[model samples]
Target: MTKHIARVLAAVLLSIWAYGAHAGDVIRSFNADILVREDGVLDVTETIKVNADGTDIQHGIYRDFPQYVTTPDGTRYKVSFEILSVTRNGEDEPWEATDTDLGTKIRIGDQFQLVSTGNHTYQIRYLTDRQIIFGDASDRLRWNVTGDEWSFPILSASAHVILSSGAQPFEPIAFTGSRGRKLADAVATVSGRGATFETTHALDPFEGLTIMVQFPKGAVAPPTTAQLSDWWWRDNLGWVVLIYGFAAVFAYMMFTWLWFGRDPKAGTIVPRWDLPMGISPALMSYIFDGMNRPGFTGDL
Candidate 1:
């Protein structure tokens, strides 16, 4: 039993040594900034400094989506990633992109030649729409930093996330290690109409740095005064004009009828009385005829 145990221990130590020896590059610093837009788009920028040991000619950086991500409401969404831009040493370098079964691989070098031995800086920008999940009560954003599958050990790592301007205020939560074995604190600040969360630490291979933030529902921007006025005219201006036009026409008809539409005889006053006893029939007839013929042009 003692002989078997010794052999097993030696083998384990050798394997550990071999694994450590194969670590090609070391990360000096890794910083990431994530901006959450109002339209559910997440804009991400990562700055990385790598200390290449001069072993390989070219370096590869890759981004892959998680198989599944669960929201606070137990709903799951398939993650997707899109790389926007990549730069090396503050200058645009030649890179080859390839789509593989695993994910996208971006190799950076000089004319497909080998990379030099030294500290190199790289910046990568990407877009992802699956990070922020909308809910009935609030929207939630889940981010995984170390989970991106880096092959090197990171000496220092930092991340900052800026929420949308219309998002409701809430505290953010962060976790570290496998299965979230440790909880980490983050600094939160409110600037202008949005909020930001920042944290910094170091990470080993396979260790995860994850964050989850909850914001209020309907975090979209409110309508501005100018926008409201434009919308009103665009949607309801015709109705308003039609109503006012109908009112003016009605007023004109009323005025015309009151001024010129009445009957001419309506203003005449006729006197009715009992004739005096001894009045001649001819005289009465003459008086009635004259009254009726006042406006009539005929032989008198």
Candidate 2:
């Protein structure tokens, strides 16, 4: 009876040790790329590097997003999510996804064992609608990273956001928010039309990670015909006024010249040269006699 009790106690202790060892899985790194389009759609691609402790049999991944978001103007937009694809180590992997009240629950385990000594990379791609809200004055996006919601701790995490066509020349403002503690060490950069945010230190569970970006109004709205015409007239009004003023001045000058500014003797011909001041009668007679010779006498 003593030996049996000792054996049972040993087995219970070993099971507890095994369970503790299996719970040691940790995330090495996480990266997310979010693309925002003009049609109010968001395409997200996530890459996660996880290190398993070689004890757990499988791994499960979950992602969540708000079902609806309300803007400052009391406008509400419905949010929807669709999973695109899932891959592990560059190969496609099968996953089971279910919609829950909180968000989405994804399970990848049975067929492909995730228990390994080294690191394994998993890439998840998905699409969401109405993630960006277009307001009358500005467009805004509020995105949350799955790093803080994961089961294990994340060592490093980064997110890159790209605005698709139609949102050019608009400045973007981005900032980060944490759930529990203040993460003052988060770094964010805005270049051209894209923004990038990164965190170097570990992210504890439930310490929410979120990014907010705001774009100026009219960035995604194309100009209507009336708007284009109004802009054209507004921009070229100065040139048009100057041209009409010049035309009026030229017409006035031409009218004056034709009506009251002409020369009085303009139609009459004038002699090219005047005769000599004085000449003797004999010299004048000789000059006239010489001019009245040969070819000069034909007209007479």
Candidate 3:
């Protein structure tokens, strides 16, 4: 059967009311749309929305910059597993496809399973033309997760038909998500009683992103992968080191100018205005010592 039908069955089986169910109960839906476009043409705009009771399979492949979406009750995820090989196809194309063993390192059979009991750091390196597959990785998933890493599809496989369709003003591509959901933000012209709202949102970096999604209620929740943030201002030792480094440089410059500077050591003598007559440090010391003595003083 199709992925959508399988997802629906899974949701039904999982949500069969084993006990009293509440609104917050989580369910998965496999055939949810997950792409969108902004109204403006200048940008590749897309917004993703989340509303679901279960987790499902969502897939997409695009060459332009990636757009992301997460929901209050639902979380969106992308999984990666990529392999490379070389092949040559033609001479007229100016690109060779016949060479085997391209730069891809991931093999088709290699699998990733994270059975972490607590928060753990993971290194993920994937290279694919564009495809996301997340499956069977969570349970032994351990860290309250049951899913495993997914497949890295071939380059020619566009996740959705929209990828190859080029850009259209009204056509927005969707990325399927969990639990009978569909989400995509594309360039759209809404016909209203009078006018339309056409705005564009910019693309974002694919790596190292921070997403804050609040639940229907105001919730301060973190991602499934707990990542901590610490500012440099909070690090006392770092601050101390920075301050000392600056101070050392300043002190060196001051000493250089006062003692061993060009004018002093290079014979570029600086004239001294002694006020014509003045007691030296040595002279002052001698005078001060004599005055302290019990001798008859200066005049008497």
Candidate 4:
């Protein structure tokens, strides 16, 4: 029937339009600069250029940072991430950070606002700890420069890792591919106390660039005990709040019962009926109520 054929055509047109909305947005460039401080913290700045189409990218973009890392021995460690600032086109932008199952997601944009279609530049400055591995001979910084799982393709990506002065860095390596792939399609270069990496070709969606740099031992201090405790509390704060709330409620109930709900102390009884002013109820009511009362006047 003609009606049935028309419905099929409408369905096909709708699917095509939906796909086009997402397919038009792309990452023009992604650049990251990492500064390895001597106090075991890494200060990073990422400048991301996005070419968004109005259809799907009306709000803004979100960046995700992975949370946990497991060693060969199966020991898992949580990485600490703190956002310093986020700017769009050289001005402050509204953003929110939340912990997701994948990691930390920094969502930038206002729900009530819409970003115009075209190129927009975003700069994110943040601090992260527990990203370095200390070894006997050297310390290692293996970081995923451009995180995988982006829905849009990236045309170019690069990173620069800077260490302190007088520190020697060697054995620089770079990998480019999807997660868990070792495709060596990138170049890593080491200078005096820094390492730089760049991808050789464009990265499709779900592809990323990971770089590594090894420096002399003791270049950066290991995390202290206090830092470890802080990270632990950060990871388990939900449980801590829950327990604290229950304890507070229980303490309040116990205090209220002790102060107000207990039985009164036993005392000797002294009975007296003086009406306080030495006036009988019948006379008081006859005077105060009405002299024409049925029984109050007679009793008085």
Model 4: residues with Cα > 4 Å off, grouped in runs: 1-23, 232-300
Candidate 2 at residue 282, lDDT? 60
Lowest summed lDDT window (length 10), candidate 3: 139-148
TM-score of every prediction relative to native: 0.55, 0.57, 0.18, 0.71
lDDT at position 13, candidate 4: 97
C-alpha-based local distance difference test score of model 3? 0.25
Candidate 1: how large is its RMSD? 19.8
Single out the weakest 10-residue window by summed lDDT for candidate 1: 56-65
Candidate 2 — what's its lDDT?
Answer: 0.67
TM-score of 2: 0.57
Among all windows of 10 consecutive residues in model 4, the one with the lowest summed lDDT is: 291-300
Candidates in descending lDDT order: 4, 2, 1, 3
Q: Write the per-residue lDDT of candidate 4 for residues 7-121, one digit (tens) a residue.
A: 9999999889755644688888999999999987889999999988875578999898998888899976678788999999999999999988868998999889999999999
Off by over 4 Å in 1: 1-24, 55-60, 63-77, 97-103, 166-169, 179-201, 220-300
Q: Pick the winner on TM-score between candidates 1 and 3.
A: 1
TM-score, candidate 3, is: 0.18
- On residues 101-220, what C-alpha lDDT tens digit does candidate 2 reach at each position? 555667764455444566788899988765665667788776776534565566667788887864532333333334434555457777777777777556655554566677776555
**Candidate 3 residue-wise lDDT, 1-300, digit = tens:** 699999998888766752233232111111111121111111111222112222221211111222222335685322222312211111111111122222212221112321222211111212321121112321000010001122111101011111111322222222212223322322223221111121122111121111111111111122222221221222244668899999999999999888877563365768875432677866765676966755453765
The best candidate by lDDT is 4
Candidate topping TM-score: 4
